[model samples]
Target: MIVRIMGEGQVELDDAHLAELNTLDDELLTAVESGDEEGFRRTLGALLDGVRRLGRPLPDATLEPSGLILPAADATLDEVRKMLHDDGLIPG
Candidate 1:
């Protein structure tokens, strides 16, 4: 799957990474649900770091649509919560 992080370019992630990503996503959701700002920040950072670490960066010339879109690294909890209810930002 190709995921686009806003403010950054695209990264190609494979099926092998999905399970771990899902776990991170769950942690993020839990943080959001509980309104835990610290947890949200920590988990969100970890999630983005995982993507950067595990995903292959697509070249600048690549223009394929992203299969999933994640918020920017600087995204706030309220911003992400808005994204969750209104958009299919994460794919299971």
Candidate 2:
């Protein structure tokens, strides 16, 4: 799966990592919903770190479509709130 971390370009992540990412995504959604800025930051950091740790970086020139898009570490809670869908940032 091609996952894009906003402001950080894209990475090619294995499908096997989806389940773990989704778990973090769910936590992110919950944190946003409950207005927990700290949790939001923590979860978002974990999610991004997980992607960086488990996925390979795509070339800067790569322009393939991204399967998922995640907000940056500095994103505001309200900003992230608007990005959520019924399935959260990472769709299962």
Candidate 3:
């Protein structure tokens, strides 16, 4: 699946990585729900880091459609909370 970071280009990630990402997604959800800025930042960073670790970055010119859209690292709690789905940012 191709995932897009709001301020960055898209990266092609395999479905095999979805489970791990979902675990991080849960942390994000908890942070959002609890209105914890630091937790949100930490969890969001972990999620993005995991994505980068498991997927290669795409060139800026790449135009493939994205299956998932992640928030930017500097995203505010409200912004991220609004982006949440039933399964968090990246659904498992």
Candidate 4:
């Protein structure tokens, strides 16, 4: 899967990481819904870190369509809230 971290470019994540990503996405959704700024930041970092750790970074010029688009590391809670969908930022 091609996962894009906005402002950071994209990474090619394996399908095996989908389940783990979904778990983190769920946690992030919970934090966002509860208005827990700390949890939101924590989970968001975890999610992005997971992608960076588990996936290979695509070259900057590789402009493939993103399967999952995550907010930037410095994104505000309100900013991330707008990016969420019914299935959260990551789809199962």
Q: What is the C-alpha lDDT profile of model 2 across 1-92, one tens digit per residue?
A: 89888998999999999998899999999999999989999998999999999999999999789998888889899999999998899888
Candidate 3, superposed: residue stretches over 4 Å from native: none
Local accuracy of candidate 3 as per-residue lDDT tens digits, 1-92: 99998888888899999998899899999999999999999999999999988998898988899999999989999999889987788766
lDDT of 1 at 65: 89
Give a tens-digit lDDT track for model 1, residues 29-56. 8888889999999998998899999999
Candidate 2 lands at a TM-score of: 0.95
Ranking 2 against 3 by lDDT, winner: 2
Off by over 4 Å in 4: none
lDDT (C-alpha, whole model) for all candidates: 0.86, 0.92, 0.90, 0.94
User: In candidate 3, which residue pairs get closer than 3 Å at backbone N, Cα or C atoms, i.e. clash?
Assistant: none
Q: What's the ranking of the predictions by TM-score, best on top?
A: 4, 2, 3, 1
Query: Compared with the true structure, what per-residue lDDT tens digits does model 4 show for residues 1-92?
Result: 89899999999999998998899999999999999999999999999999999999999989999988889999999999999997799987
- Runs of candidate 2 with Cα error greater than 4 angstroms are none
Tell how far residue 34 is off in model 1, in angstroms: 1.1
Q: What is the lDDT of residue 70 in candidate 4?
A: 89
Q: In model 2, how large is the Cα lDDT of residue 78?
A: 94
Best by lDDT: 4
Top TM-score hit: 4
Consecutive 10-residue window with the lowest summed lDDT within model 2: 66-75
